[model samples]
Target: MEPLGAGDPIRLGPYRILGVLGAGGMGKVYFGRDNTGRTAAVKVLLPELAHDPHLAQRFLREAHTAQAVTSGGVARVLDARIDGDDSRPWIATEFLSGPTLDDAVRAYGPFGADGVRALAASLAATLSDIHAAGLVHRDLKPPNIVLTATGPRVIDFGIARPEHGMTLTTTGQVPVTPGYGAPEQVLGQRVGPAADVFSLGAVLAYAATGRRTFDGTHVAAVQYEVVHGEPRLDDVPAELRHLISPCLAKDPAHRPTPEQIAGAFAPPQGADRIWRTGPLAKDIARRGAEAARQATLVGREPGSGPSRRRLLRASLAAGAVVAAGGGAGAWWLLREEPRTPVESGLASGAKLLPRSTAQSGKAPKPLWGPLPVAAKPVDGLVPAPLSLRDVVVFAAKDGGLAAHFTRDGKEKWRLPDVTPAAGLHPLTEQLFAAAGTSGALRVHDASTAKLQWELPDADVGRFLTMDDENLYAVTRGGQLLAVDLTMQSIRWTKPLPTYAVRGAGPRAAVAGVTLVLFGDDGAVRAFSTIRGLDMWTIEGQGKSGSAIAPAVVKRKDSNGTSYTVFLGGRTLKALKFPGGNEVWKAGPPQNGTDSWGAPLVHGDTVIATNGTTLAAYDLDGRQLPLNGRAARGPLPATPLVRQGEALWAVEADGRGVSAYSTTDGARLWTWSAESRGPWGMSGAGNRVFLVNDGKLTAMPTVG
Candidate 1:
């Protein structure tokens, strides 16, 4: 590797580029070393190609295709940055030592019979692995084959064709290596694995004879020679000449498959160390050692092995939690940046006013914090208000643990300490429930903070809902479990055909005696609370349900039928309770915002916000008389329902609240407060609570 020139980027993401490996038509490959002590061949697309959407897509396709081929015979793609304007569209792969097949054969002459057989087997195996993954290596020239200590590893998947139907070249452009081009590729016809086999034959013939099978002075001549003419297997080993001849068959169907060639040239005994004592092996070792020293100087110690590196790259790319040692511990690569504490609007030790203060014509001042307690700051948006006697419960967005504080801003109780993994939540106003990491469910009394009952065999509960008598929980596995609080045990548990979609919010409802469960498969299933029998199931268009609980409404019609209203994808539909019939439906906002939070039900009005546009619908699904005025901005948070009005939130851009009349859609009052988006809202009596950023402020309902 040589030093980088003036125009090169010194650092790409976390990896430091040390030098240039080579430059191609689309990009330049660099020698990069990461902080983890991993050396990589980093390929960055040229700036012009990076800006082209089609070319960028092709570049990303190359990275994804290279990443998917997990065989040791192929170099592993370690990282990629393919999106965004500033993105240079780069991919880093394992940096291989030694020379390319073209360079090695040119410098050291043809490989003898033994070496040729080994090369054929290794290359054939690599091709077989690629084909098994439903990919065709469109470019299989000798320069793309790196001869390392391990074997002949194939590289450069920039022109690979995967089964997903993506091709290598753009309109009016052809991707092919001149001398190695197969007849189909030369004619720009439908090329597949057969075309790759033709190229492999040419590459092997060149390696064994130090000459191209079909030679020409120019690309046009080369295409002409490859399409109609053939020759030059004279120097190829006599024993393997027949195998190479079949692979070079002009009619692709007559060409031998990679599996057949690999079977024919099985690795000789002690072939694993084939490159051990050769001059080429010494060169490989020397370069490998130099690269290792370079990696060490850059702070990355060598990782366990290739398998470990592959796992790291994949998990990090998908932002997955790596649970090693058989679920002993989980490592989260996706970490929310620690939020800087927002300035509190509430003064410390502020006095709490009585509920009758509304009559005095003055909005209630903040009683206390942003409640001051020694718990980890809230990271996720707060769920529904958990009423526990005189206090309400608040928890992190994950519902992992919670804190309880009185209306007067005094600390009351907290779940078994303040750790986030506590997973404690309020089951009712009097009982708090927690699902342990071990899938054990434990119930505690709100007043005493003591264990009331325990179900040691319950599945890990993702979210909880309850009524006056029994508690309902939807486990992570999509099982609906109803535990009888009166009986102190699980009454019955039924697994839904499909649970809530992964990454979507959990939605469930306990309306009166009917327990309604919404599946991620866009189906709403209701069961009888008394008998745990399936009451009815209504399937909607396959849209995932929202994170919020369904709004349960009872119509004042002749049948007085109750219904569970759900927000799935962009559509909102009401399913008749017990009977599970579709009653009314509302599609997404057509001309306005696309973002919609959970619909809040106030009086007879069903209010939902898509971005900043607030709409209201009656129990019959008819549009209410809402004079749509834009709130401050889009409210991703669920609207806080008070008395009979919908308090629309504008938390992201503008920090404020607009209380609108749910019946007539009149703007009652608007309160502007400082906040970051993702504000949490809940209300009781005359006080509406707002938790924005790390600060909490109480807004008066009437004001």
Candidate 2:
């Protein structure tokens, strides 16, 4: 929670506001408590918007609608002041002390089948109660459901209305969330309790698989999919799919009622224990304790033994509320920073590259320089550069890992003992993982290069990938080792498949609970992050001599959001995540040879090379057209990198780099160097960093 800012009220009604829990464009939700020691989430309308009749009525209606539902599955309204002109309009509800469903799923990974069933039953019962109150909850998405000590408790009645009312909206705004909303609601037609049932199905799908049932690239496309497309349940477990499918029926009349859904799901006896035990329960208990402490310190004076401000600072320092997730509009007990891929311990995906203003067909000038900071190639291989938030890291020519400012080629800091070959991975935006001498795992601050933590017994050989909880690496003996970050101890170790350890070390990526490793000898393997058990494997994807490094991209298509691994070999293949099942495959161009290199994914397109030609394909593996002049190149076996509209790779001659327009694969510009060495490329913050021989250069991206 943030400290109260200027112009903020100290109290509302009988409650004393302690800190700001969360805020939206319309108002703010304050962490509040009364003299009786009861805590509440007090939502008050913005003073400026209080005079706006439309917003004021909506705010008041939320209070009335929320108060009407008297179920233990919902947050009870403690007090409300909506009728008086002299008072500021506010509604205070019991503060829920737990993460929202969205936050929980994103932080802890998707729930197991039994856990999802428990969630389904709890939410269904809540929806049944809301419908019984002669009202319809128009917004029943993940963020509205909080996983408390008891079970899931539905919160937020901001858009609820009478069951007979038509969907309401101002101007062109849609009344419901895009992917989770029912078709009738998307059409702005009359919605019944069935709308909430449809939303429940979407929520359950996400809870089961950590993916939405319907998704698209933009808001309009998602709404259109909700209206006209079928719900994607391929990723949802087979046994549970049958129960969730019926609730997402396109027609309202075909969807099951909340009571029927509750009966159908019928969680096992003691299923509620899923939320009452394990790490999730521990997190909920921690938050609850923090909330109680905040309540006790609320009315303390400035010079008291321990001030509320100091307690809040202590809470933040203790990582009490680390990250918030879900829709931006959802408010919770305590707001925190949002989790990024680095923070969540997930594989980083393509960021939205900044739009360049340079002419589309013109060659852009260098943004920084061709600085001589890159290390010379070791056995014909240059370490791939890594891009952090503000600095680009490389293996310095003087022998060590060095960080250079992205804005300019100035050196920020260097670690002479760090081994770039051991594989450098970002643990968070501010911290990174690398190996010190003798294969010891070390964590360093990104900006200061200070050693924050180290594990001397890790016996690290090659750093692979990491997630929120553990850092995965391959030991010198070719065994996969998982080190738990929270416990600072080894979690598990498993022997690598014989094929995976025969040649160069494998490249790895983490998606959800699965960690995928692609070996140099064309061996692909998937392991469960929870236990280091083998999940699946595929052999002979490429020739024995070739190196393979597959790229994973999260794409939303007719099959919903798929964490697909794009593997390039004789064929460019898209494999479903976790299972390594081939979704689609495309062979090389009609007359081209069968050899292919590693692939790169940007947005919806996957780009790769076949030694003689560069090709682009959609996530579905359908080959896309490229301009004739730029499509053909004697590209080497290297991974492609993208920045803005340009896709950069080694040019035909292998001594320079060429940038192609991502849209049509037309040649945009080219940069050549005199050095006769391999090229490495990486991009971040709208600038592309290139390493040729031992020279590093940063080039500006053009439209």
Candidate 3:
């Protein structure tokens, strides 16, 4: 792909422009098509970084952080414009084609140990979905992967960052590649996801020894043998050099994880099913049948057939495959028989209220309706609900979200202006997303609330962390994104840790794949949501402005590991995961639990609350004793966990919903009713869901 020059631009928005698919340092790419004949690529920018507006807002934040990731192994992006006072950006994507695993290992000659264990299980599942959509492929060599016939895709994210975010270049320039970098990215230090597992073990030691496990003869002796070398795994293959010698370990905490190289090179049941075969799968199916016969002769501009935007994207992929066969995508929806509660009494306008016990006596009931559906508070707040799939939604403070029908509270579709949302996240039990302290975001249709995509301003970030296919956010300019809520797109965007002057801006959460972020100047950082990078930072931690929010847990006897609990200033800590280290801390201010906002690990106990202290601890800081006084004011807008024998909305007294006991916090039941004041609560599956001050209830789950 190369022609198109004569000063390019035969269209960039709806695509069209034809040849040229290459050029680097963030410029020119082309090879497009669109009007339904699909085939894309695009890129564009470079006119002195598109007339520099700070390098065109870092090239429109590299097309929204390479359009926030969606991996079958990468290369999807699909569309972008940029706009920050006038536009002209470009991005497009989705055209993998073939060649460039360094041109198929310089025309076939090396790969063989089951073809480098199916190319290290397809780039360890594309660096485990580009570090699980946090992104880091900070240039994973071999011309940024490519070899596709439906297999290795990866592609250039240009010098991707965001494990926690920082450096778009300038502080002592160092964007790696000195013989597949890593040794703290050639000593510039701070590169994470173990420097892309040491560039995926030097791209599987250059596909099983064609060489480059740190060779020299140039670039300052390959940056002094990549920080004092030792890599040359002499023709690797000792069972893939025991998985490429811990991904070329040089203490990026002794590498390995791309989910331990996709569980040590998985691929075997029909080895990559049909991802290219023989003569590079007949040279990638004869150049994809001459690029679909040159995209049906440049998509015949004379009488069409399949183009109403490709029949509304094939009827939205056949109505998202018949709304994904109905339900049970599971975020809770369970039931062997529940649906009996509603007892305590009172009727007419409804009132009910009482029911506590459970030190062992048991009482907990009300699984729906202590009654009343709406009469007052729709603006004072009651925003939690959002179960998704089986539909629960709610939000409403006039910003509308509504939905309902988790059995028959009826209603079903509303989705309005979406006021200040800040919740309802989900991302795929048929899609559901929200974010709006005004930076907007939107995305609905969990059964037809319609809308589908928005973005507007999109700087979003007060909190939102999804994962059934991305969503995680953090913007108001801090930027962390990920997004890809089933192609409403974005799968990547990092920038969060900036502080050359302005202060407060840290918080962030996302547990499972790590992604902390502490600050009040007591600092914290962490990061690795599958490779976004930066995996450590403790600093002063004197706890600056702590409203807490850094809980991540997973040590039920450490089989899956993960930790990072946090409280900091008055101390409480945890940390071990993806190596933030600390292990356990505790300290000053225990009883009056230092203000909080993110801690609900459970299983080895961790729970936290700041509606005026609600503690629980025990990952070694002990504490755990609450039988009576715990909930004092604002927590529970979603944090309280446990979910088996009840513990869902942890002690909320004012508009009721208490339930405690995870082995001894007691309280047990309290449902309450007379409307106007609850404002938030969540749990899902067995159910708990609240939203009061304007109705949005649901109950069940009392074990």
Query: lDDT tens digits, residues 1-703, model 2?
Result: 5566787778787777776666766778776778788777788887887888777776777878889999898888888775334355788887777877876775555777888889988899999999999989887887878888888988878778899687856565665776888999888888899999999999999888766778876778788898999999998899899999999999899999998988888889877776799657877887787667656655674456546233433222122322221121245322222111112122112223244533345455676678887888776667777776557788898987998876557788888998776767776545678888778888887766888778888888787777656788888778899987755678899997666755455777777678888776776778899898888777777766565677888656696666888887777788886466788987753345555777887668788875555687888877788642333356666777877677787765666777777776766666776667777787765567888788888887753
lDDT of 3 by residue, 33-132 (tens): 7787787766666666677777667655665776677767767677777632235576676665565565455344356677777878878777777777
lDDT (0-100) at residue 129 of candidate 2?
A: 93
The digit string of per-residue lDDT tens for model 1 on 574-598 reads 7665556677787764455543556
TM per model? 0.42, 0.51, 0.29
Q: What TM-score does prediction 3 earn?
A: 0.29
Instruction: Flag the better candidate by lDDT, 2 or 3.
Output: 2
Report lDDT (Cα) of residue 115, candidate 1.
75
Off by over 4 Å in 1: 1-365, 372-381, 396-405, 417-429, 436-439, 476-478, 496-501, 511-514, 519-545, 555-569, 592-596, 637-639, 643-658, 661-677
Q: Which residue ranges in model 2 land beyond 4 Å of their true spot?
A: 1-362, 497-499, 502-504, 554-562, 589-592, 627-632
Off by over 4 Å in 3: 1-8, 11-31, 34-38, 49-94, 97-119, 124-138, 141-149, 157-171, 176-181, 186-197, 201-245, 251-307, 310-703
lDDT of 2: 0.73
- Which structure among the candidates has the greatest lDDT? 2
* Cα TM-score of candidate 1: 0.42
lDDT (Cα atoms) of all candidates against the true structure: 0.60, 0.73, 0.58
